[model samples]
Target: MTASLSWQKSTYSQEQGDCVELAVIGGAVLLRESDNPAVVLRTSRANLADFLQVIRQGPAKNSPPGR
Candidate 1:
């Protein structure tokens, strides 16, 4: 049987529509939004890490702190 994913919202999200969740199950990372849990995005943890790294090094750096 497939194991259920334990999804958690992003710390940066508020109680409204701007909610994102992530989980690691086996060899893949799962992503979803609180506004719609019926759909999911899956990818490798390495890929996710790389994407985050790029975001960190990109224009997101211009975002206000404490985000």
Candidate 2:
């Protein structure tokens, strides 16, 4: 059987201008905007998990905040 791909909004999304959508396909991860679905960024599952871990770890005081 083949795995299907679907997109879902991020739970971290708030009323602010920030929003994101994620898709899982063939053991990989894909991310895109809630408004613009045409553009997508692809990454490995491990890489995506690591990226999320870093984001969850929060930013340093001297570091520029992510958008």
Score each candidate by Cα lDDT.
0.81, 0.78
Instruction: Please write out the lDDT profile of model 2 over residues 1-67, one tens digit for every residue.
Output: 1125567778878866658988887877888887776778989999988988998988877887673
- Candidate 2 versus truth, CA RMSD in Å, comes to 4.7
Model 1, range 1-67, lDDT digits (tens) per residue?
Answer: 1237778889898777568899888899888878778788999999999999987886665778765
What is the alpha-carbon lDDT of model 1 when measured against the actual structure? Answer: 0.81
Number of the predicted model whose TM-score against the real structure is largest: 1
* Total residue pair clashes for candidate 1: 0
What's the count of clashing pairs in each model shown?
0, 0
Runs in model 1 lying further than 4 Å from the true structure: 1-3, 59-67
- Give the worst 10-residue stretch by lDDT in candidate 1: 1-10
